[model samples]
Target chain A: MSVGASINARGLTKSYGSGEGAFHALGPIDLDIKPGEFVSLIGPSGCGKSTTMLLVSGLEPPSAGSIAIDGRPLTKPITEIGIVFQDHLLLEFRTAMKNVLLQQEIRGLDRAESRQRAEHLFARLGLVGAEDRYPWQLSGGMRQRVSIARALVHDPSMLLMDEPFGALDAISRTQIRHDLEMLWLETRKTVLFITHSIDEAIGLSDRVFVMSRSPGRIVDEIKIDLPRPRPAHLGEYPDFAAYTKRIYSVFEKLGVYKFD
Target chain B: MSDQIAPVTSPPTPAARLIRAGWLWSILNSVLSVVIFLALWEGLIRLFDVPVWLVPKPSDFLGRFLVDYPEILRNALATSVTLAAGFGLGVVIAVPLALLMVSIGALERGLYPVIVFLNIMPKTVIGPILIIWFGVSPLVSVLVVFLMCFFPVLVDSMHGFRAVDPRLDYITRSMGATPWQAFRYVRLPASMSHIFAGMRIGIVKAVEGVIIAEFIGSSAGLGFMIMRASSFMNMELLFCGLVAVAIVALIFNALLATSERIMMPWVRPR
Candidate 1:
């Protein structure tokens, strides 16, 4: 069993260029995630949700603040992490199996163990026969599933998913949401999922952080107290509707939804 | 349910069969068209009683091909060897140089403009200049072919390497991939389809370059044979030389297409 790492950030900010021309992308924000917790950042475009994920992954340096993973100040891209992007970001050349194995190949992990784990993940993700297919051969939904398997193959301590199901069809979105929740129930990896879907943010996450537009800051944090295995029709759950309404009101206040 | 199963169990439909046999069918179609064209040419030439010096009949070149088989074979072989050498060298040099240039911003900024300037100038003009520099040797022919191919391969390869989505780099870096590992696993494979596209253009240019070089400097090769045949008014031999060059170019293209399929199987129609 793999224990998840807690994520900590203080005054995390990112700005591109300099002086009068500088574009402030994110932050002067603070975030703390407990071990094995599921959290989501929901906001409009340009809210720096993706930027926040990038900084936490340490793929890019923050202009002004600091991040600590498992209480260690991060100076480099952390290895014990999996990242999924909206584009699926799969290498078109490799088969689905090889793409999943790439994590093991890069990390120099035990080959047989990684292969076994990858096979298990494939089975769990409903990707049994898709291991040999290239990204182009698979449907949009199957491709996303393969990407998810790749993210989890190495059993990372933290999973950072940025709109993993945004491009998927409605059915795939629902199915993958359920599958992701079930997987989280099993591994309990610390997850920081970013999305524009309010229902998704509330349904999958233990806590949802609503962010403001442009120089984004976490405007509100809503903890969902709903029962586990959240119902497919989230509208049936009174608390789910309350959570949705609360996030909507934050967006409305931020001028995302305007009424004359 | 029975209707759905019936379709699966039945023989393949005509459209499916045609698509499955598409490659062979296309080749046969091309062969048929060429044969018809040759028959028309042979008939017209015989009807007009035209002199062979003016334009040899298809049969006339066919006869020439049979009688001068050894000579044509030798010259064709020479041309093939020179083309292979020059094109191979160009690929070897250009791909790595493109990689280096793409990796280092300063090198790309410094060198790309000069490369573009060179590419814009006519490579044909440089054939005679190369002969003058290298003194009418096989080396001059090789150098000309190299010059012809180098630019396109380099430019397209640079484009391929730089065309990678920035998110891909982040994906690899998040996994703690070293720069070399990221390049080897991701950048190189991602660039292959583009690299092969460059090679396709390079091979065509190479065929043209070899003939130009042989036209100016070499005493051997199909180009030299064509020149010799023309001077003696042996139209049949000139036509034979031309046919040989066409076959060689086709072969190079076929080889490249096969390699592309092997290297980047994802690009093949599923």
Candidate 2:
């Protein structure tokens, strides 16, 4: 039996409070993500990108919208979705290996299998020696690596990353981006990454969804026809610059970016 | 570039080394001062022709206690047992009460004023009432000790639980952790320092509690021994009793400090 999954959202409206104190953070909009697609949501701060990711990950319920993952309505527990927040969010007391193994505990996988999977992922992510160390002992980049390893340990078909590398230095961010794209290419798991950087959206995404501020809605979707196993130097390419420029123009037109 | 490549392991600076050595020297100095104090005390008693009942020298106090060592030991054991029981009871009550305060805002609001009122009310004033109700028994002494030491533990634990990082709580909840799981994993671990802080204070207060209990109601502990010595104007025995209580309190505090170091090894030293 094949366990195939795709995420679908329609008329997804989220409003905080009611009556005189009503506030709409996100859409009465619709979104559909096909299986094995890398989609990036790019917008200004407070544009509800994080909220959208939360809603899609089944972490929060939509007020009016319905979400169906793998054609099944997302009412019950979802075992095949992994989420990464801006902070690595690893349990400080647990070792990096144990942190990765937590996904296995959550998914109710066997201990031996979980350990094997965690070890394999840790090694694959260049975290071999750091496995026994606690989160506090590791650097920021290493902690983020642990988070990615944790997300992949359960072999989740869908990965939701909310600015996963946003807190890192420029060098670490670029390196992680390269590694992430490589991982995505190898695994072909459906990924929804949210970011504020147009360059990042263009660099890593197969398709970028540009969102507007206030009541967040997808203003435009730009397809990047970038080839597989994307080179680190791809950012220097005219085509990549053109895609970023176009996205920036859309932000500028939406008055979200004031490009002086 | 060569300097950068070389792994340079620097030794402690002379100033830092001096400071580290200074602590040991100061401790030695303190011991010397204490010895001088006792010798002077013994000499003054001998020279001034002080009465044995009023101020028996350190030697006399030590000689008498050593000969009657078994009796003193028995009383010490009784005092220790009562102290341990009272301390244990206070811990058992305080931890859950702190957790309750942390969990229920309404309950905390309702109880805060009462706790504040009770904490300020003199334990000495309550002593007579407790003895009257429970009688002059070991049980009453233990109960007195418990009452005296309970609030510090409760207040400290409540502060610790409340002090957990809100961001960490948010992270745990977003990870699909249940409420109990969040408390167990995040809140409880984060509150450990605060709990330990309360425990350290509680232990010292527990010693005070035992003495207070013994003074007012019980007849078998150091407090009662001191009271008896005072009645007969036996200042040396009274001083001996006081010293014994100080030693016990110091030992308890040291144990707590050691345990805190073991439990929270990651906590940066001030």
- Candidate 1 structure quality by residue, lDDT tens digits, B1-270: 000111112234435544454434546766788799899999999999998889889988888888999999999999999999999999999999999999999999999899989999988898777877888787888888998999989989999999999899988988889999999999999998889889999999999999988988999998888989889888889999998998788778767766666566565353
Clashing residue pair totals per candidate (backbone < 3 A): 0, 1
Could you tell me the TM-score of candidate 2?
A: 0.85
Using all chains and alpha carbons, the TM-scores for the candidates as numbered come to 0.94, 0.85
Off by over 4 Å in 1: B1-30
Q: What CAPRI class is candidate 2?
A: incorrect
Clashes of 1: 0
Best candidate according to lDDT: 1
Looking at model 1, residue A101 earns an lDDT score of 96
For candidate 2 chain B, which ten residues in a row score worst on lDDT? B1-10
Give the CA lDDT, 0 to 100, for residue B266 in model 2.
44
Model 1 Cα lDDT, one tens digit per residue, A30-51: 9999999999999999889999
Across B1-270, the per-residue lDDT of candidate 2 in tens digits comes to 001111223334434543554344445665688789889999999999888776788887867677766766777778888988888899899988999988899999999999999988876677788888988889887887787779999999999888776655444544566777777666777788888888888888789888988988987988998888889887777877876776567656655666665565444334
